[model samples]
Target: MDILLSAIFSSEEEEQYVLDCMAYLMLLMAAWTFFCLLSTNVPYGRYAMYGHGFPVNAKFAWCVQELPAFLVPVGLLVWTSAAKTSLLTNQLIIAMYLFHYAQRSLVYPLLIRGGKPTPFMSFALATLFCLYNGFMQIRYLSHYAQYPADWITRPCFITGSALWFLGLLVNLHSDHILRNLRKPGETGYKIPKGGMFEYVSGANFLGEITEWVGFAVASQSVHSAAFAVFTIVILRSRAVGHHKWYLAKFEDYPKTRKALIPFLY
Candidate 1:
């Protein structure tokens, strides 16, 4: 029995050590991503730069890259005893994370309307990101996160949940508008006019930023905050690029529309 107990304790210690190292690595990844995106945009689809490797099916790339976020977390939760679903706070937090990935990985790809191929390098990097972040987030929540039983009733959680819901709605609506922008056999891009598009040139990007901001607020963890910052850095820059592209392409592109934020650049 002593030998068994020692082995169990040792295993637990090793698990924790691995997770702690991953947390720091995630932080490093965020910084690296920020720097790369700062210097050059994320290479995918039309924005993809040279030397991004060969092309892959856009839908396949998206699904494979994104699935790790949804699957890895759940696998960790089920296979490990670190995070239990019995806690209301944990349940709610995990649910929110899973919801976003469920849509992104499973639902969103099916809705893509003739998207251009994704670069292999872009797909590989995205896959690495989702897997790294998925494990880091779930490990933090299950093993390290601490919250009171009544934490869900707090103002932060309440406001964050509301914001997340609103962002989800706006994001889905904006995507629908974008998908319908071009009908069958029509190739040209049109200005997305409805929903949040009227206020921001990149409504989808804004929605994702809002979602992560709310996520960070709700989690109140440095890890979540890092993820949120990373999201903003990448998406905000992409939005700015798209805004410029639109202006260069269209003579009547909205002059008042901001890149990602509404009423403010």
Candidate 2:
């Protein structure tokens, strides 16, 4: 697809224009999604229902929906003639993006223990987002992004990279806690404890939001910033929804736990 796009666009500027348009589209999506999720939950995980769309195996849905985010960027690196894949800054940032998706698409699904089926509509939307975002991010990095040779040594890069790694650890640990919440053959939800879950209902979402925001800071680009905004919008809603659900369902739920952010939220 990158190869085909390279052939179709006669000038580099035209290709960048298209990428910019996609960035704008992502922002619009973030706004729309924010308003929509304000009144209703996304039909997935505990909120999933048959009425949302056809049901798909949860593991299969995760793998299929997430794979393109990892793959498309790689294809862009390998096939796109316009890409500056050799740049160290681009490579590092792209690798960070790939790392998260690799876990989501490949590792996370395999570890699932009898997760509920995902609605096909939710699955399809997730898949579409991965493709769209993956392409836009990598395309910009490999082709348009420019940084000094000392970029890796810079303060913003160092701080952002640290934050990204910290977020990844929190996200992974939170996921592990959630997955282990139930023993084998056990059913129904349990309040997740330890790590970030003690403080926020959406530990996983908080970790991801932190990661993208860190990525945006390090990359210092509108494209990455747009992704961070979209992530925050969607994950914030999900976190709030989860927090509300937990409170309503459990008589002894933690009263002090926030939704996405700790304390202030």
Candidate 3:
């Protein structure tokens, strides 16, 4: 166990490591995301019928959409290390990954109650992916400690940090609102009315994307930028799908609202 942990955490550098690593990570994440979308049933659509008691199709969109979410970070870790960037970037990336995993793996599952059985195959594959990512991210961050002392005071950093905090607040609050809307043993869709929902259908996803985009800008790394771009691609697609679903389902749904963006799409 100790050896496995060490291997996951340790970083070995080669020339152009950062760029290469980021590229590979992005590719892997993109691939995995695509597979998830293709292989498993669409949770939202499936839940609408079995879990939420709404009628929806269970079609899998193109597999490409899945790749960006996971691959980007994986690629970033590899490329950043190879490029010999500062440990600060590595630490930040790792922290973000772990933080994200905690939410997706730990908190998300808990929020879900007894409903349609989540397919074991899908659950197993997703769990493995999350575990692998969690280890890699935490390991890299643990080894990374030093940062530019003035990073927090810099304008870019300040702005980025503010965006990150805002995103976090929106994501958390949006999730809270959704969870509260559904009572125990109740199965049906409920419009999230408060918080960022007033502006966008997938406000939670938008918040998460914004958070990472801020991180990338604050760190000023190509690796981070790549991750941000990939995130935007995947989440935007999901947001668009979600927006259409909302419009079709709710007659009183806000017509003026965008998909992922707040005011303008």
Pick by lDDT: which candidate is best? Answer: 2
RMSD of each: 3.2, 1.2, 7.8
User: Local distance difference test, per candidate?
Assistant: 0.83, 0.91, 0.59
- What does candidate 2's lDDT look like per residue over 121-236, in tens digits? 99999999999999999889988999999999999999989889989999999999999999888899999999999899999999999999999989998899899999999899
As a whole number from 0 to 100, the lDDT of residue 154 in candidate 2 is 97
Q: Write one digit per residue (lDDT tens) for candidate 3, span 1-265.
A: 3344336546345323543474468657766666565433345433332442332221111111223334544555554432323455445545565466446544565664433444334444444544443333333343333357676678887787677778878888887887788777777888888989999999988888988788766766555565666567667767877888789999998998999988898
- Per residue, candidate 1 scores C-alpha lDDT tens digits across 1-265 of 3244346547756756666676666677768777776766678766876478888898888889999999998887777665446787877888889999999999999989888888888889889989988987887787767898788889999988888788888888989999899879999778889999999989998888888888888888777877888788888888988898898999999899989888989
| Ten-residue stretch with the least lDDT total in model 2 | 76-85
Q: In terms of TM-score, which candidate is stronger, 2 or 3?
A: 2
Model 2 regions lying over 4 Å from their true place: 1-3
What is the TM-score of each predicted model, taking all chains together? Answer: 0.91, 0.97, 0.66
In Å, residue 224's CA in model 1 sits off its true spot by 1.3
lDDT of 2 at 207: 95
User: Could you say which candidate leads in TM-score?
Assistant: 2
Question: Which regions in candidate 3 have their CA more than 4 angstroms from the true location?
Answer: 1-11, 15-19, 22-97, 115-147
What count of clashes does model 3 give? Answer: 29
